[model samples]
Target: MAQNGTAESGATEERPALPLPRPVTVQEIRHTKVSERSTGARLCSCSSSVSSVRLQLCSFYKFGIKCQFRQKSKARTNTWCSPQMFIDNEWRTSSRGRTFPTFNPATGVKICDVQEADKEDVDQAVAAARAAQQRGSPWRGMDSSSRGRLLHRLADLLERDRLLLATLETLDTGKPFLQSFFVDLEGSIKTLRYYAGWADKIHGKSMPIDESFMCITKHEPVGVCGAIIPWNFPLLMFMWKIAPALSCGNTVVIKPAEQTPLTALHVGSLIKEAEFPPGVVNIVPGFGSTAGAAIASHKDIDKVAFTGSTEVGQLITEAAAKSNLKRVTLELGGKNPCIVFADCDLQMAVEEIQKGAFYNQGQCCTAASRVFVEETIYEEFVHRSIENAKKIVIGDPLDPQTSHGPQIDRQQFDKIMDLIESGKKEGARLEYGGRAVGEKSLFIQPTIFSSVKDHMRIASEEIFGPVQCIFSFKSQKEAIERANNSQYGLVSAVFTASMDRALSVSAALETGTVWINCYNALHTQTPFGGYKMSGNGRELGEYALAEYSEVKTVTIKLSETI
Candidate 1:
């Protein structure tokens, strides 16, 4: 864990501008000089504080990449991370020869022009993916062990380019540099390696049967996978979908969110450097209505995995259903609850819950938007939470000292502010920060509301911002009831010292994952998904391999003489 004390040091450096392929109105990519910050959220004192809030994960879970995480790494001194689409192992402009501007949310400045992929581009990508995974294709004929090595190579490439990817992540999405470096990039590397190890291990099994016949169950790839990743964690989600899908010998057509495509596009360059076979992994960056909808409705695409809003998930599912009934897996929005009991560690709960609430500027689907605390400790929890919220230094994502960064874009900023205003109108007391912070950027203060009612929009709706609502509960039953009242069932936590209360409450909660005394502590080994409206299918661990695999049963007739 990292220490909370703030500090300042010496000089800093920036990556020189890389030449663009084409001319367009581009803002000077601004990278400010600042003190060298420890690549950890200054919230703990553990030895491996860089791993963010995964409390028990001290190191990178023994993946042996510890040495790669150096003290300070600047963006690579190289060419610009191109915006061209990666299909058939080559970078090219869209079919329509059009481009769109992606901005740095922190400064509200245009970063660069990206090729805008539409339905035509999606068709090209899906076609490439389909051809790559066909019966006689090189990708399909490659041995599983070789595929695993390729994935490991991809992981190594990502590790080597960590600084570049992290910088691009921060520049595009407006997440803190430290977070982009230690949390997102580290997680992406770890996930790739994890799935890499699973590549050869995914196999078929022969089972006992009647004497006259033999039965075999073979696990085969689901063919071309259509992935539509969310913007909040671009690098992580990019790896999340591709790691497992590719590990299981499936080709992918990924549509990265339009808001934060820089890092994914950068990863595409790394994929080329890693020497992946053509069309094994393709990234198309565009809006949901075009690229995303195309991925969902493309009949040639065998499966579609999405991580975004519940509404979008439904649309994708409907499209998939209408077109050849493609298999769909969604990791959608959540209004997760953090239930704090009287017997819990107040300070720890306050800090952890607030971290979950405000991390990624509260744009995460699993944001701890609702908090139900026992009345005995509600006031104290709110007080400490507000104090901690004040400690979040919101500023330019490039600044090392800054902890919280801006929201994704102006639309998200306005949505969050509008929700905060709705909280005020609905009679919830604004206990702390509740408005936009910086004038030019998309940064919003970590807002907290107290005396929240269950029916209020702030409590029921997925705010997807740094807005937290705290409500009081009289007893364990009331707390459980209130926490389970939302349409989302992604994740929830029970804060308590009593094992009995913790176990009972966690079991009773209508959530896919329930933590005891922690919030948003996810691991690569954990199978993460949701129930009810939060969507279906797991994203990590052994279970995720199932999402990209299909079962084939073969029966062989034995000779009668036998």
Candidate 2:
């Protein structure tokens, strides 16, 4: 059994307060500096009881030399970093001259003012993409190797400015700095590099025919791609869609979610630095109703690739069909399942469950929101899970020590709270953590609900919050049935000592990706998409390259037989 305070005992110790040489104001602290003493200088000693004297001495050192200091000024609240949208070959805003305020959920403070693109912007972006697809455009006749070089260069630039990108992502989306830096940014670089390596390698096989005939096949770019990315992994998902699509010789009209558009706009600058031909890559940041709808249904767009909610995915599908019957790839919502067996490692299981549920505040579509534990270890697993949840440090994302941060915005925070209340009203036991934590932030406690039925809303529907619902299962058969009972089939996980049981249970789960003894693991080399209502087509890997290309067969008759 795990000890109750095992996790809390390892809490990071607070740093000791240091007394400065002088009494300096808060403004001076911002610009304070230090210098090394000369070799012959004698050390000055002070008694611990003389606290004020020590402070004065520190201030004397600070002011004695030419040192940098900060001046106390009015708090610059309500500050924003406004970045313009990139359309065609130009940086422009909506024709209607409208904008939306994007807030930082950590402080409920406005981080930036984003342009709210309307129909005019979307149409112009699509037209530019179409123009780029024409014969005379730079992208039209570009060789695969050259395209690969451009993408590789872009990856290099991203790596160089990773810290800046990480800060921007943290400020805009409220994700932890380390998470955004290591996970999101690293994944994006790997994704771009992976696709870059594939650029020159993609080829179509020739079909064998009778000796009297000659036949050949080719894969050509789809042209004029419309990419709609969600806010959760804003820059990462954008790279996932655009890197492969553009590397495969397609022009893109990308529409980033309005709430977190900074990183995508920053990417536009990177694209320019990469020297990608104008119109080959365009971005329009705005509301889903105007910019998103316009791009999805645009007659000129040859294909549409989207990552977001199932409801919105359905709407995009309908719009595509109604307008131009555009080729569509949708990576939508998921209510993923994670099964824990009695013989599994309890410690590792608890850790994976914590990461699966609380990473990104459970906004990820592949997060393990539901857990089905074997009856033999149900109570113990539940207890350990609650203990682990309490140890999760939730606070400002800017703090490097913070493990989890607030949800994307006020609306998402309120929706998650409502679902938690519903789970209580619907008779699920609130095991732990069912409230917000900070006053200035929208942080929600990592919540767990026990005794949840398979049909309950908390178990069946996609809550998309840090809520874990646990169900007990008596047998493998029952576990498989319960896991397969969801309308979503995006991802599933199983933990067991027996390899046979792990493989057996994974095989029976209806999800597209099944993890054994793990949860929410991803790679750029792997294909990711869901079965059933989880949406269609795969992103990443070679399959994603195929998504942007059309296969064509050519045939010829020989003049004479061999």
Candidate 3:
């Protein structure tokens, strides 16, 4: 064994060296407004069982560092590195020194303990963000071009660490690594770069007024944004909220969902490396009741953005209203419907519909949960859908061949199973899988419920699992009506070759977005959100900028100017 770096002071003796430098734990981070304060207790330890030997201190040496050991399997492995909340600029624990274990849903293995942000931690993060937003602050004083440059640099860093980020995401969320790498990570990078370009382009407009006066309107950042992201697409959601908010010069206190915080914490390191000003971006991981509610209701927070269930979205809205009437942008639940007409290509519809409903294990908010097929092809669609469900590989997310992994956690898995049971009891035919595949983890079989009526719980409610509900209808008007029967209006799709029918159905569906012959087609250029209870405000495209901005009109009296 060879030493890789210089030894730290107080090393009594040199011993076998580690093949790689031990990674620094979050507890070692210290800087900025959230000041480092520990409870002076070693909450956890990472050590090997074998006879330990001290090695030279590596470049990554810090407090709470893990011990690396060689295994009998001829592989080097490190103990789990505990995650810490990133507030202001440093990584710290909750004020009470509390933490909760985050597990890999795929294996039901405790990956590491994540620092839980209590109200006190949330307050500190909010205060730091508020300070960053104050007048004359470095973040607020920076020029738009400079801001854009920083965002671009962050994007570059993200591109460089794409694989690592994807791996972390897969480990935390049970999403396929390929999907995390190709879709979520790529989307995050694109979102960062897209908003980076918009930083300098954020503009004001001049308007002609009366002869005596000149009028102009400018889009300014809403200060100290509190953003809460969902666990489904952890990194992607973080980028969606932060990119536009930071581009518009708003500081942010972000709360990544408790279930999936690894990738977000990893991104915090990149934020530090990007040289973002102190307190500009803070990442806090905790439950919705504590950190999330604190962010929404904090008096100093200017806005609150959430992406989650509609039930939680309502709570956030109420919290904002009770506080400062902070602006709220919510992208919530969906019971999205896909209408497959007889004129459409059968195989294409089958493939895309499967992707729509089962992508990410159907945890997507815009998943085409309900499918209304023309009666002529209803049987064929159901058969194909059942076959497709069977083909979905259920295994470790690390395997690229595994198309489906476990649900986010046990709670979600149980909820999905309950819903499948209800579908069966309600007289819907369970054409395919309807239960958990294995007891080891949270894996649920890809399920299909045919003859599902509009009123059934499985059809109306968002299972948010690998469950698809199929219904048959006669006419285009009937299909549209049936599709719009839900409170959710996030996204819907239509599979038809008829130009007129596609146009009419797309227009008729009460959804934020209607895709024709496609599903889950998202781009930074297109705006995405829900129309009704699904959520409020848009996410992608230029429309997202509005959620983070405030418009102020200024009028100048030409003759009255002193």
TM-score against native, each model: 0.86, 0.86, 0.87
Clashing pairs in 1: 1-44, 1-45, 1-46, 2-44, 2-45
- Name the best candidate (by TM-score): 3
> Highest lDDT: which candidate?
3
* Per-residue lDDT of candidate 3, residues 1-562 (tens digit): 2255445553455559744211123222222222123211122233333322112112112212333434454423443446677776676767888888878888777777777898999889988888888899899899999999999999998887676667678878999878898899889999999999999898899999778899999999999999999999999999999999999999999999999987888778678767798899998899999889899899999999999999999999999999889999999999999999999999899999889989999899988799999999999999888877778898878877888988998889889999999998999999988888776568888888898887889988889999988899998888888889889999999998998989988999999999999888999878999999998899989999999999999999897744
Clashing pairs in 2: 20-58, 21-57, 21-58, 21-59, 22-58, 22-59, 27-70, 31-68, 31-69, 31-70
Worst 10 residues of 3 by lDDT: 52-61
Give the higher-lDDT candidate: 2 or 3: 3
Q: lDDT by residue for model 2 over 365-408, one digit each (tens)?
A: 98888899999999999999999888888887877778788899
Q: Which ten residues in a row have the lowest lDDT in candidate 1?
A: 54-63
Query: CA shift at 75, candidate 2, in angstroms?
Result: 21
Alpha carbon lDDT at 414, candidate 3: 86
